[model samples]
Target chain A: MDAAIRFHGVGKSFKKKRVLDNISFSIPKGEVYGILGENGAGKSTMLKMMANLCLPDQGGIEVLGQKPSWELYQKIAYLSDRAKWYSDYTVEEALQYGKNFYPDFQMDRAEELVEFFKLDRRLLGKEMSKGQEARLQFLLCFSRDVELMLLDEPFSGIDLITREKMIELIIESIMERKLTLVITTHEIDEVEGLLNRVSFVKDTKIVVEGEVEELRLKSGSLKELYREVYA
Target chain B: METRVVGSYRFILDFSQPIYEQLVQQFRQMLAKGEIELGSKLPSVRDFAVQMKINPSTVVRAYQELERDGLCEKRRGQGTFITSSADQVAGLRREMAENALESFVEVLKILGVTQEEAQKMIAGVEWK
Candidate 1:
């Protein structure tokens, strides 16, 4: 049981406002881990630290058994909460960008996903709806053969059908490969079945963290636990 | 028979309980009731995971429990299959019946019903 990501007493601050305080946890390889919390509870900050998108003010973070580096970035796919595509690029061009930039990107899988998600190749990024944009972003990230995937608020502002499709793709990816996924989302019930483990962050620290099934057996459903912890 | 086998396993999972335990219980009950045909191949771990929309590890756990209980066997390079032995099936059926009766009696005790009253109720039931 090797760890795919580890955070040791990590802390972060933005303009003197402390967001995360002394966070510590580790996600095992091939496990689907969820970082659950309300908005601005430092869930996204933890994901950013793993992706090397932000620097921690204290302590250290390790990914794939090493410090996060440019070389390691190639092995990790980080999908941001605010994913913005090149407005001028067509759907086909957007996928081509992923192929050219990510050496691990599979064109065949991308093409298959494009059809599965029902995206029009000729449609421009600016012309697509919110749900369609989310689909495109997810497919782009999912087409890569990365070892660790960091998804921040993947289901926010998306339609129900699109969210279900994303969940299906997540399960399929887990089955097909040895992938460790770290996702932050408010929609806990939707991904409850997919998460092997979860950590609930509140007031800049993890209030609860353990195997989802064990926690559920002791307390209740994750949704009920979420209410008890955050409500 | 193939359709029946596939149709019987469409489980609407309840997350309040341990998911793997629920899967194991369902399979155990189905095997005891002769619902699942012996020698039929179960879905592969990967396929079952996708079909059930659950983690593959959960499916593996349930399948391992089934194998350990002698209700199923996994052949190398082949999928898991239900036990073809009538003796094993009969054993499971008897064990399941005993478990059910024990639970019923326990509930009756909790309700403060005497054994004589329980026997009378059982006798009053109309068997199909």
Candidate 2:
């Protein structure tokens, strides 16, 4: 498989707290990978580095075989739990803004997703409910025809029904476009079925990474293994 | 038939065979024993993941295998369901058991156990 992203001896820190320590992993093209960790496990920080929102304090990071830069921004779509949008902008306006930034943005898909999530195009971002905002964020990120997508807590704080819908949407998008996705979530069970591979982060580093079934066969159960390793 | 409510559908399946093959065998057992009723809702990937504390992705793969084998049907937004007919399950079980037996014999032979000795040992073990 082609390499979509690579990290080499990557380390990041905020003040005295180290977020990622000597992290190294390679994600293959056209694969849905899950990054699993508890709170404060460096998943978000690592994802930020991959998105080039934050530079690694040490080592190197690459996406689609190149270092992330403003020129490569269009090739990557990043969604996080704290997706910030102009509060006064309407749903349509948000889509328009996204298209301005990402040349490959799919306007039709964005419109379809807006309708799918039942978000009113006229409604301002600030007026939307939390779930609706989340749906909007997801729609915008997914509507971009990018090579790599980094989703941070995409399902967090959503109701079960919406969460399921979001998961289905993500799966369908990946299948339709063959986009490489890296999702970070604490709710492993929710997204576990959708991932091709899983990587566990602990002590500011990736401690486990491999195909999901192979890990299950070796450890009996992933939950058991997680407790054993991180307990 | 009394439906035994298994708290979670997620199974931490352990067998000498591969994960997908092991899942197929377990589904067969569930069918043969009538533990899973026809058209009954199998555990959702999330529910199963929580039950087994495994990734939902593994459950999805197993469920996909079941669908491919015509042992289950997936309903969008709903959970997977067991096929109504028992014939398919029975046929698959027979084929799987044959393969499993062959593997067992091969391992025993590798361990230098004679057929007679293996049979004797099998006879000595009590089936619960």
Candidate 3:
């Protein structure tokens, strides 16, 4: 299987504080892969590097078979934990913005996702609740026909019902588009079943990575391995 | 379905499947049997994890699976509770069991266990 994302000797640091250390891994195409870690374990930092939002201090990174750069930006959608929107823009405007940046953006699919997520197209981005904003961001991300998606904490601030809907939407998109997703989240339980594989991050490094069932059989549970690694 | 309070435990899980699916199926079955009692507190995610000696995430996955099937609801700051539509649990159980049985029988056959021997082995189990 072709790799959607690959990191080689990837290292990052901020103001002398190391975040990611000698990280190396590959996420195969058409798989829902997870980056599991506790808060401040550099989960989001690694995702940022993969999304090309930030450059690694050392080593190489690839997204969609190419070096992380502006050229491949449209082929990948990165949703950070802190999703921002123009206060004056409506849901339709956000979709349009996405279309402008991403050549593969699907307008009809955006509309369908908005409807499915129950977001009002007329509601201004600023007027939306936290949950609604998360849902709207999710809708926009899903609407983009990207080859790889990097979502950093997509479930934060969302209600359980909305989270479930978002997960189902993701599953459907993964099946239909054969998209590869690398998600970082604290809500491991919510995404456990959906993940085909998991990469456990600890001490600013990837300690374990493999098929979910294989790890589950060995560690007896994802949570167990997480505790053993991070605790 | 009737729930019997055996010993100090409020309920029992009678499925002869893998522990993970058994945990999920039994929880749903408890709700269907009214043993969970709507509004009654189910086990905590951590408590269940310790009891099963598995990861809390696995317990959480099981609960999330149950929630997705609409057999349970999780309230923020409160524990999960049985849903009113517990009858749906029966359909889910049948579907899951059928899938598991298919794989189980296939594996048994692959391991050189004849259908008759499998049946005999299954019948030899002493049920209380």
TM-score leader: 1
> What CAPRI grade goes to candidate 2?
incorrect
Total clashes for model 3: 0
Worst 10 residues of 2 chain A by lDDT: A187-196
Clashing pairs in 3: none
- Candidate 3 per-residue C-alpha lDDT over A145-186 given as tens digits, one digit per residue, 9 for 90 to 100: 778899998987688888767776776675466788889987
Winner by lDDT between candidate 3 and candidate 2: 2
- Encode model 1's per-residue lDDT on A20-76: one tens digit a residue: 999999999999999999999999999988988888999999999999888888889
- Model 2's chain B yields a TM-score of 0.61
Residue B83 displacement (Å), model 3? 33
**Model 2, span B24-123: residue lDDT tens:** 6667777765677777888776655444433345567778988988889998787788887778767766877788899999999999999999999989
Candidates' C-alpha lDDT: 0.88, 0.77, 0.76
Supply the global lDDT for candidate 2: 0.77
- Cα error, residue B33 of model 3, in Å, equals 19
DockQ of 1: 0.65
Residue A81 error for model 2, in Å?
A: 2.7
DockQ of each: 0.65, 0.13, 0.04
Q: Which 10 successive residues of model 2 chain B have the least lDDT summed?
A: B1-10
